[model samples]
Structures are given as C-alpha cells and as structure tokens.
Target: MSTPDTLAFRFFSLHVVRTRRLGPSLVRVTFAGDDLAHFHSGGRDQSLSLFIPAEGRTEPGVPVEEGENWWQAWREQPDGVRAVMRSYTLRALRREPDEIDIDFVLHGVGPDAAVPAGPASRWAARAKAGDRVQLIGPAVTDNRAIRFRPPEGTDLVLMWGDETALPALLACVEALPAGTPVRAWVEVSDAGDVQQVSTPADAEVTWLVRDESCAEGSPMALGAIKQAELPPAAKPYVWIAGESGCVKTLRRHFVGERGIERRQVTFVGYWRRGLTEEQLRELPED
Candidate 1:
C-alpha cells in the first residue's frame, strides 16, 4: 500500500462486465473501467489486491487520497464500513475494450460443502454486471508482483499448483516463449475443473483430480512427482503454490530431495487450511 515514488502500483476502480462459469468450481469475472488505461502489467502470475464491497453494501469504500498514506487511511476506517480485501491473480488482459479477467475458485459454495464459503468466494459466486470493486495492481510494465520468473540459462520449467493457484499457473504457461520446455502438474477438487491451455511453448500439463479417495487438504503432488519421470535438464526452474502446507512439502521435495537449487525455485502459499485470510496474514511466514 505504501509504494515508492516510482509508484509501480496504484489503485483502479472497476466494475464487473460479465461472469462466466469455467467449471463447477471456477468462475471468470471480467471487469472494465476508464481507469484501466493506466493499468500495466508484464503478465505471468501478476498479483492484485482486490477490495470488494462489504456485505450488504452496493460499492466498496476506498481511501479518499491516492497518496503514500492511502493504506493507513483505509485501515483506520471502522471495520463494518471498510471493504473486504482479497488477493487474486490476473487471468487475462485485453486492450480493445480495456478489460481484465480474474478467475475465482468457488470453494465451499455447493450444498454439501464441508466448509462455508469465504467472503471473496461468495462475492464472486454472485457477481453480476455493474458490480463495483477496487484493486491495487501494477502500473508499470514490469513489477515485483509477477513471480513466475524463469532465470536466464534455464533449460526446463517445472510447476505444480492446486485449484487456488490455477489461474496463475495458466497465466505463466501462456506467457512462455515458443519452444520452451515445461512440465506442469495441476491438482483440482473435481475433474470438471480441468481446462484447455493454449500456449506456444512445448508444455506438458497433467491434471490430477481428487475424488472420494483423496483426503481434503492433503497433498498429492509430492508422491506424484516422486514417481514421475522428469525430462533431464541441467538448469530447471520450479514454481509451486496452493495450500501452505502442501506448498512447503513440495518445496522441500524439489530443493532438499531433488537437489534443485533453492534460488531456482519459487513457492507461494496461497492459503492455509483452517485459517481465514486475515488469520493467515497475522502469522509469520514459515
């Protein structure tokens, strides 16, 4: 929220243009606004802090000034009057109409859901055209929020992610250069969440669907990667994200067990099991 004078990031007021169901558990929300003309991103796992209206509110409450102290002002507001903020990835951006797409994983929205849906999921589930929101996103063509960086001299790209990270994983894949070799594993709660990825890169994507046999919040990535055969590459870059516990396990597998250099791998904990987003933020990173 307190950006440097370069102001690589800034706030944008946007409204939902449409919503499309990608699968039983995923929805793509497209947003457009006059302010998008100033938004810029290098793509590939770009992060955004979205502020949605609080429950029963028609629009989000944002800071009055777009200054370095905007975060302080927003945080000082009464809890009931402040907007609910959540982190999400940019799925796609189009220039013709100045629109951007964000994919939301609708966790716990079904009748038999074991856990109740969170505010962001609930909001995204019912999002309709003209619904207003504000987001803090990149204003520079290249910024730090985009984390899927494969360093120079990398021979192969490896990735693993769960439903919560699918949007980012897909964006990274779509941005790879032509003929780049990539191996990716995506785990989803249901087979319906599997998607078609189009990319110029030579990417091999494997979808792992959890059924009744797989335990909730348990990771399948470690075992799957252990048994699989990876294409030999001297310098391989790895990216893993999803639940915090699973991400740590996979990071260990790649760095500690597989002997991949720690610096060559990027891991993000999108969420932690049994913890609310605010609760997760309060805890120190492991």
Candidate 2:
C-alpha cells in the first residue's frame, strides 16, 4: 500500500496507459491511475522516483511503511525481489484523464547500438499498456523537486540540457512567459532525436547532435556556448542539466568565466556518464 513519504510527497500506484516513440532515442510513456487525483506538481523539472517491477515480475515489490523509514525497508529487500527504482521527470500532465507523460531516453537499445541499455531503458522500450509501476511524486504544487526556479528580476534565461534532460528543458521553455528572452541548447544522441518545441517566449534554441560531432563521454555544448554571443542582460538565470561532468563544466563557465552569481545558476546532474543512479547515490557529494 502507498503511504506518505513526506508532507509534500506521497506514493502513487499507476499503470501504463500507452507508449509512443517520439524518435529513435526517445519514447513517451503515459500513466494513469485513480491515485493520481491527489498528485500535483509545479511541472518544470519535477522529479519523481519511479519503481518498476524486477525482471520476470509483473508488479514491483516495495515495502509499505509510514514516515521516512521506508527507504531503509526498501533497501533491505532482496535484490531479485526488490523493485528497480529510477528517477524521471514529468513531461506532461492532463487533468481530464488524470494522466501524466514521462519521456524515456532509449539509450543503446538496438542491436547495433554502441552502448548497452540499462534496466529502465529496456523496460521502457518494451513497455505496454497495463504495466504496473509505482511513483513517489508531489502531492502539492510547488514542491522541492521542481528545480527550474528563476528568481525575481531575471532579465534573461539561459538553458542547456542533454538528451536525458530534453523533456524537462522543453517543459520549462514552454512555461516561460511571452516576450521573455531566452537562449537554450540541447544535445541528443542523433539528429532524429531533435524535438519541436513550442514556446511563447522569444527563445533561441540550438540542437547539438552527438552523432555528428561529440564523441561519447565528451561535452558537446561547452564549445558552442563558449563561442555564443548572447544578448546583453543585467540579470540572467541559467538552468543546466545532463551528464554530471558536463553540467559541472558549464556551471563553472557561467559563474567563474561569465561572472554570473553562483546563486543565479541552477545546475543538476540528471545522470553520470559511467554510473547508474544507484551507484551514483552511493558516492559522497562534492
């Protein structure tokens, strides 16, 4: 049974309603459930902990508990019986049907792919309707997981993301007010992964394809951003997410090189290049 994880967050039992291939490297999965009626979000880069069934199981095995001890209980579960947890961003939410969309990056999914796909990628690639999953998500709007906050008096918005962060980046862009000045860059595995972004803001977006220029494990956007001639702004807010190392590099460039205040730049490492989320969580923070 689902329980409250925190004051602002609770567990929701959901099942896949449908799946659609957005591109060669992206798939959108829509989930619906009665429990979603209470689910709410501010929705820019709202993060959620999604638990899918382990291999050969139909439903995820998670411990039921009250308060924060649920984390320890879950960690103590047997590896094979334990649910596979992954972090994801909410792409779209619909009120009429109480459905939410999560865009999954189908990294290294095919036979000819250069790298091997992870458990979440494999699960998403073959996901079908009625696949049960669980999520720890927001129960109220303006929760802490949504990280794309621009402080008051932000005259310019700058953004960068890789394929993994593309969904969140697009959502943030679309949410910006009309006439807002923005410059954004997104990097993806291939040109086929480029998306059509509809935003009311005066935004300039650049798409960088890894297949064309960047080798795996290399930072693609840093060089382009280094040469960019951004419009003058008294105050700028920068949001960057993607590969951890790349994100750090960009953060340093903005704060150290461009003289932007550290507080004005928001950076998140959506994923590390060589580490899984579980492995990443085990390491000490910098």
Candidate 3:
C-alpha cells in the first residue's frame, strides 16, 4: 500500500500506534503507515527530519500531492505551515508490511528545546492506534554520510555524546564490528538519566552525570576523556557529538592540538545550548 512518493524522498506519512518510556526523559514512539514501506534502512548515526502536523489537522503539514516536489509545496504553503520539524537520528529500522519505528530523545521543557511539549512530543506522548502525522527529510543525501564505515583493521572505536546524541550512540554500539575495542563516554543531566546500553563484551562504557546546577557541559565527561588513557593502537577512530561548544572543545583538543588526522575522527555538533535546531542548522561549517 505504500506510495511511490514515500520512496522518492526520505519523507513519509506515519501513524503513531504505540509509545513507551525508555528512561525519565526519553520516549520511544512506534509509527506505522503505508508510506513506511519506503523507509531507508541506513544504520547508526543516521538522522532524519520529522515534520509533525499541527493538532486537529488531518492532512500533513506539507501537501503530499506535490509528489516528489513536496519541499516546494512546503515552501509555497499559504498559511505557511502548521508543523514542527526536528532532526532525529534513526536509532533502528525494522521492516514490516507497511510501517517503521522512529525513536526520539525527548529533551526537557524550554523554548529552545526541540520538542518541549511541542506538537511532536505531545502527539507522540498521546498517540493512539490511529493518529497520523507527516515525516520528512534524512533528505536523500546531505554531504555527511548517514553511516560510518571504519577502515579495515580499525583497532578501537571511541564515542562520546550527551543525551541529545544518545540515539546515534546507541546505533553505533549496536553496529560496531564484533569484539571491537570501544570506549564510550556519555553525559546525562542527572544520575537517573543514565540508561543501560548494550555493547560488545570488549567495549568499556562510562556514564558521566552532572548535578542539578551543572547540566551537561560541567566539564565532567571532557575531564574524564582528558584523563583517560587510550589504547596504544594507531589509527583508532573517534566519534564525538553533543552540545556545539562542548564538541568544538573536544575537536580542538583532539584534532587541532593533538594532531589526530581528520579522517580518523568524526565530530558533530548535535545541538547547541540556547539555539534552536534551526539556528544550529544555519551555523557555518567548521
């Protein structure tokens, strides 16, 4: 029952049929619809743009009648558009008859927060068996590749992120080569924000928590990383993502100061403090 439009671009129409709490601040929403059949199955660290329709609206925030020209329709919409689009990593993709599951990391309350009790989170929280919405982007191809394919003989993998980047972290852990040496540093708002992550037996995972006033950038994870002794193997791959400032600091330290080769590390500014996703998107390339 899927339409050609669904496969044409990374966008699709979806209906939320189930929801679950993965942790205090994280929620996983499972969506299904005929359009899901066209979903691209690119794994770990892959991100897609979700276009959530406004409340009480039956049609998508952007018209699907544009077929492959949906983005044009979105730009040309009269009342502008009643939708909120957020960038989210595709944590996992499972193929079924006509559906897919997209897990979203729900950040807490605030105007700058991507889903702060906004239409996307609200709909996901209350979504029943029949609720429908529109999804867009992953946008076919951005300059950055969706999945990372490490070079042969990669001895170790180092990954670091805050909760905002957890979906990508989870996907990376799940897809890494079996028994690959891994060191992970994850920062969370509070101790309770930590969630159990499954990684290969050889992987070493560390959870860093910030106190009430500290939040994520309290230098906890960065300090730990500074003190950590990396395996003495040449050409270990590093993947870092989180707040822009924090990530930029690490990038400066690792790639800028330490002289690590750029290709050996992937640093992403997943989000930034005080900036909306749109603002973050508008930032110049580093």
Candidate 4:
C-alpha cells in the first residue's frame, strides 16, 4: 500500500550529461533523463532541489514513492544513505523529449557561503558525461498570485548578488527583454570568479572584488548601487540576493526608505551567513 505521505507528483532520474565552467565560480550541469519529459516549464525563477548520489553509489538515487507511506519513507531513510541534496534555481528548462539543463552556482570556499560542499559542487568539479544525479523538486508555490516576470517598461534593471546567487543572476540575464536597459553588480572573492553571461538587453556590468581582506557583509555592492543614478521614473526593478542581513538592509534602502514599490523589487535570502541550508529552512519568515 502506498504511504499516505507519498506525493502524487511525477519524479525522474537524470544523468549529468555535460558540465561547463561559465565563470570562475559558476558551473552549469546539463542533465538528461526520461523523467524530465513531463516537466512543466514556465517557472522562470523557481527553485528546485537536486539529489546527488553519495560518493561511490552506482545505482540512481530514489525519490520518495507516492502514497501515504511516502512521508514515512522520507522520514525513514536508511542510515548512511549516500545522498546529498542541495537547493538551486531552475536556470533554464528547455524540453527536448528526455533532456533538461539545470545550472548550479559553484560556491567555493567562502566564510559567507556557509552551506557545506555537496554533490552539486563535487559533480560540477569532476562529473563526466555518464554520471547521474536525481532531481527532487520544482517545489510549487501555492500562491499563484506571486509570479515572477521581467518587469515591462523598465528603463533599467539592477541586479546584485554574491556567489551564492550567481545562478539566478545568470538566469535573469538570459530571460531579459531585448534592448531593455540593465546593469549588474556582482561581488566575488577575486578576478578568478568572473563569468560570462549573455543578455539580450543592453547592460553595463561591473564586478566587485574582495581581495582577501573584506568581510562577508561589506558594503561594496551596496555602495555601487547607491552611487548609481537611474533614469527618472524608469520603473527599474531591483533584484538582490545573498547573505540574509545584507539583503534585508538593501531591501530597506530600495523599497522602504527609497519609496520604491514592493512589487518593483525582489529580494531573496539565498543562504544565511552562519546557518546550514537545513537550519535556514527552519528559520521564521520575516
């Protein structure tokens, strides 16, 4: 009998067919699987969970099967199951009968990027064409009211992020409207972390380097943002992601103190400064 907690959603097994270094800190892993054939597209900025097989496991990782017992199965994984799961955004979901590409940001050793190194980074570093990893989620948000789309009539779009948010920033750039004005401020450890991103829109991109002395929450990006002046009433949308505290401060300056409408900005706490993903998940929403 299927467990009561088992979900009715379709699950798929995918293999990492390719890996590419788009930038010093960004790695794109392309996955192909029969399971992705039914994946629903249209989630421009949605998040997904990647289930990586624990080191040395040969068989593909399994998803919690459907039914009431599904929840039980999740709660009762065999001790030492060789699987590591990490949350990442769906950079692009192009469907070609049995293939999908998911890009992950390779957040290397950083005090601010506290999430433990997992299969995603490991696979990106050494995954060959035949290696496989299971994909677990496109976690659907129930409130359809909260959808994401590049704002229209936008004269300028300002995007800023630390390494933890590189994937989303790339995805945003790729989805931008042609000829739309945009600017990106990316903060990285050093010049080695730079990556190339293609955008249909015109953009002035800047990279901020932390040359071994700056702290995680330094105001480098924020300082750049403050100095930048936009076209009058250009309907600019500000997207910022990174350390929770830093993001919150930026949010206040843009939306609260600066009088920008709430809908004109998107702020995400990709990961907290000192908490693991597991712990961050349990934190209360602000």
Worst lDDT 10-window in candidate 2: 211-220
Per-candidate count of clashing residue pairs (backbone under 3 Å): 0, 0, 0, 8
Of candidates 4 and 1, the better by lDDT:
1
Model 3 pairs whose backbones collide: none
lDDT of candidate 1 at residue 24, scale 0 to 100: 92
Q: lDDT of each structure?
A: 0.88, 0.89, 0.69, 0.67
TM-scores for all candidates: the values are 0.94, 0.95, 0.83, 0.81
Q: Where does candidate 4 clash, by residue pair?
A: 3-67, 3-68, 3-69, 4-68, 4-69, 5-68, 6-67, 54-82
Candidate 2, superposed: residue stretches over 4 Å from native: 1-5, 65-67, 211-218
Question: What digit string (tens of lDDT, one per residue) describes model 3 on residues 1-286?
Answer: 1222343355577877777777666777777777665566555777667777666765557666767666656656655355656767776667655545566555554455434564556656555666667766343433243645566888888888888788788778877767888888988765666777676537888998765466556487778888998887787888888788888888777787656778888887767888877566667766
Better of 1 and 3 by lDDT: 1
Q: For model 1, how does the per-residue alpha-carbon lDDT over 101-195 read when each residue is reduced to its tens digit?
A: 99999988989887899889999999999999999888998888888889999999999999989999998998899999999999988899899
Identify the candidate with maximal TM-score.
Answer: 2
lDDT of 2 at 148: 95
Q: Determine which window of 10 residues in candidate 4 has minimal summed lDDT.
A: 1-10
The C-alpha RMSD in Å for every predicted model, in order, reads 1.8, 2.3, 4.5, 4.3
The number of residue pairs in model 2 that clash at the backbone is 0
